[model samples]
Target: MKFLDQAKVYIRSGDGGAGSVSFRREKFIEMGGPDGGDGGRGGDVWAEAVDGLNTLIDYRYQQHFKAATGGHGMGRLRAGANASDIVLKVPAGTQIFEEDNETLVADLAKVGDRFRIARGGNGGFGNAHFKSSTNRAPRHANPGQPGEERWIWLRLKLIADAGLLGLPNAGKSTLLAAVSAAKPKIADYPFTTLHPQLGVVQVGNHSFVLADIPGLIAGAHEGHGLGTRFLGHVERCAVLLHLIDVTAEDPVAAYRVIRKELKAYSPELAAKPEVIAFNKTDLLSTEAIEDKLKDFKRRVRKTPLLVSGATTMGVPAAMKKLLEVIDASRRGDRPADAPGITTEEWRP
Candidate 1:
């Protein structure tokens, strides 16, 4: 199925059924009292986060969803049948927003999570309910309440333990492919991977999920070069693997550009635990690599790791470090080396 992270949907709850206006008309009874029955309640509209779904492509074709209206009440004190509810199954980590897209209605981050988006209208009372001691028989019945209707937005963000970040052609996909079973598209050119890909990496006795998204360019926060839309996929990651191309001239500058984009998009993302690695080490000579590492250390204020995704060199060490940070994050201990967003409103 095609990937669709965002979709706009129009949803409406079912309207309640009208109450019946009838009297007890028996051949033996001379005076008949009001015996109208109450109407049935309408159906509700709900959203559920279920398994086996990772995309919102299904919502792309169907934009409108309406529940079944309740059945009208019958004569002779016969109640109407209640309408069944409608549930919209969405992927985990899907966030529901109001029409403005700013007000968050629900955050479904786990499987089987459910939220009622619209409530069914209440059923109206029958004529018998309005009958009092002063009035013997009532001729009027109350009408059913109208259902609610509104437009909502659904946004999905993938959940992963770690995320890979880099500029285009910086070998982010290569590292994920080498450590995990995911087969992300790799090419010599830039922007080879347009969609976000997920992988599970194993290090020693533990394994953690990893996500790889398209590279970020300058002014990505302002909608530049695919913008920072895909960044939402990694917002929940405990740590970020920042890869820089060692073959690029002034790799430090390239690193700073991505950092700027991250900070621009969200300070919470910028503050995440970052593990910097100089990729494509096989293409650089020992002397050249040593010099670039020293330059990066001075500029970034931290020692960077050397990893060759193609040759799988120094990848084990990178995975181990990522696992360490992930474990620390899971333990509720925010290590100095890995401080990510903890106060983000929703996973998406």
Candidate 2:
């Protein structure tokens, strides 16, 4: 599995069957009436959300999907069989968009969620239905209706309780691997983690999902350096963990760069609850870390936590603080420890 979060596919529903045009001709009954049967209905095309799938790579190879057509009607007042429906299984949180790519068609958030992409055509009437007292020998039969067809776009957005946000090589992967079971590829260079990795962090009896997206850089909104492709994964998160590398030449500048990119991509994302963490504390001296913390507090008017992913220093405390923030967010209350400026109206 190559990770593919977006794809475009053409889908078509089955067409209805044609009606039969026959008359009952028996040896004893010389004057028989029409005995044509009605046609069967066509099959529908539906998209369903299922578990165990996190990507849309399957749609890349296969771009066209068509349902089975209905069977034709038969004589002797016998109806044709209905066609079988075609079901497409997609990952949860898959959003269906129209051909324009901006209009939303459906948003599948939960498992087993389904939406009908194309509707089947209705069956046609037979000659027997038109037979009446005035018109005994009817020979008219209608053809089946054509099925609907359209091209749709599928986009996946990962759902999580908390998301990690930072510039490249900001120790996000290290922090996630240290706190959760996720084993993302780590390297000293930037863009080591290509796709988003999800992990479940258990605190006592409670557990919440955390998503680690690829590092974002300046001009991310203009489709630079992986662009804002992975930013949609964090749109559903309740809280954001902002990790700033303390060893950077100017930690404040790095922090501001990421924040500018986030706000440019989506103001709502920047407005989400954020927890600031000064990572890579093991690489800096106590005096240096204290000086940087003091500068950050003066600029942001809030105290940031110092954590070392390599040495696991203050990691537990960071996890506890994240949990508390998530709990407060669930209760519709802003977290006191790390608060964000409200920029938009809360939907729910």
Candidate 3:
């Protein structure tokens, strides 16, 4: 199925039914009293989070949702039937917003979450309700109330344990395909992966979900080169794995560009635990790799792992390092200065 993360919908609740105005006329009875019955209540509009769905593509074709109107009342003290409610089933991690798109209405982060978006109108009173000692034999009834109507926005954010970050053709997709069962499109051109992709990575006996989003470039936070549209998928990650191509013309410049975009998008995102790695080492010889690693370490001032996604070299060490940081984060024991892992020290 095609992926869709955002949608705009229009919804309306049902209107109440009208009350009846009638009097009983029985045989051999000299006096008859008002016997008009009351109207039933209208249906409501609700939203619920369910399982087995990860996209909002279902909302692309249909955008309007309306509840059924209540039945009208009848004579001889016969009340009207109530209308059934309408429930919209959305995927987990879906957020609802008002028409302005800034004011949040609800956040369904987990399954089985529910919220009432619109309430049904109340029923009207019958003529018998107004009948009293002074006002006997009443012949009037009340009208039903109107329902509410409004437009809303729905946004989805995927949940994962770790997110892959890098520039276009930086070997992120290659790394994901090598490590997990996800078949992300891999090509030499930029932006081969248009949407976010998730994979289940098994490290040792433990497993976790890994997310791969579209590559980022300069000015990505301000709507350049796919913009920050897919960045929201990583907001729930425990750790981030930043991959930089070893064969790039300026690896240091590439690192700085990604870092700047992360900080520009969100400060909290920038503060998340990150693990940097130099990928595509298969293209370089042993001596060339050593020389490049020395210069990169000196310029960046941070130790980075060396790996080749195409040949799966030094990949196990990198996965183990990522799992370690994820475990530390989950246990709430991540240190302020977590040490970086190198392939030489932690070979798998």
Candidate 4:
């Protein structure tokens, strides 16, 4: 189950069957007319979106897909049988592109979505069709048409309600595991989580999907440390959760670095509604945490939530705040939650 978000494959449709050329030669019918049968249409190639799949790794092993060819026509006015179609199942949110990778052919965002990649060739006409009053003994038969073929690219983007953004080892994975059911790899070292993980967070009767993306570095936009390869997964998210490690030497500097990388990768991502959280507060003393919070507020003029993912302290409060932000965002509120609203929004 290696995670693969992109793939390239070649698809070909089946060719039509050839028409039959025969004449009626019965014992009592000496002056019989042509009795050739028409050919059948070729099979088509299609791509469909199905559930229980999250990657395009299946396409890595097999790159070519071809449909069955139509059966040839027989004598005695017998028509050829149509070929079966080839259906390719892919994960939801998969995007189909042409060989150039710029021309979008289809976007499968919902389950049961389907796209016809290649169309089958039409059947050929038989000699009986050309027989007329002036041309009674016609013996001409047309050949089958060629099928269509093309190379396409498939790209998958994870769909979620919220996405977590931060630098390496910023407790993004810890926060995700603390609030949701997802158990992403967590360690003290940087880049412990190399891929994006999804989780569902339920608050009372409401639930929303959250995605924990791989940590980013300073030159992430320029292919540094996993770079912006996973950035596309966050493009569909409705909100962003910016988690900054309060125990870092300079929390403000860490926050700015992630912001710079996000803006460089996609300005639209940086413009998304974000909820800033200061994580790993359990590692700091009460006085030190207060000082860090004061500095964070004075420098950014925004009050961020304080939480400890390891000890689960303030975790419930954090989840409540996130739910409120998600609710406001769904309501299409401009600038969903204002700065310095953390104190008033969090009841616990």
Residue by residue across 1-348, what tens digits does model 2's lDDT show? 688999999999888888899899999998888999888888888888889999999999999999877777789988878899888889888888999999977878768778888878767778998998899989988888889899999999997899998998999899889888889999999999999999888877888888999999888999999999999999888889899999988888888988999899899999988888999999989999999999988887877789998888998887778889889878885546332221121110
Candidate 3 lDDT over 79-157, as tens digits, reads 8888898888888888889999889788777788777788777677788778999999888998777778999999888
Q: Name the runs in model 3 displaced over 4 angstroms.
A: 332-348
Q: Candidate 4 — what's its lDDT?
A: 0.85
Please list the residue runs of candidate 2 whose C-alpha ends up more than 4 Å from where it truly belongs after superposition.
331-348
Q: Model 1, range 163-200, lDDT digits (tens) per residue? A: 99999999999988999999998898888988899999
Q: Which structure among the candidates has the greatest TM-score?
A: 1
lDDT by candidate, in order shown: 0.88, 0.87, 0.87, 0.85
Candidate topping lDDT: 1
Q: Candidate 2 at residue 32, lDDT?
A: 85
Model 1 stretches astray by more than 4 angstroms: 333-348
Error of 4 at 43 (Å): 1.5
TM-score of each: 0.94, 0.92, 0.89, 0.89
**Residue 206 CA displacement from its true place in model 2, Å:** 1.4
| Clash pairs detected, candidate 2 | none
Q: On residues 120-171, what C-alpha lDDT tens digit does candidate 4 reach at each position? A: 8777778888998899988888777879999999999887888988888989
Which ten contiguous residues of candidate 1 have the minimum total lDDT? 339-348
What are the C-alpha RMSDs, in order, of all predicted structures? Answer: 4.5, 6.1, 8.9, 8.8
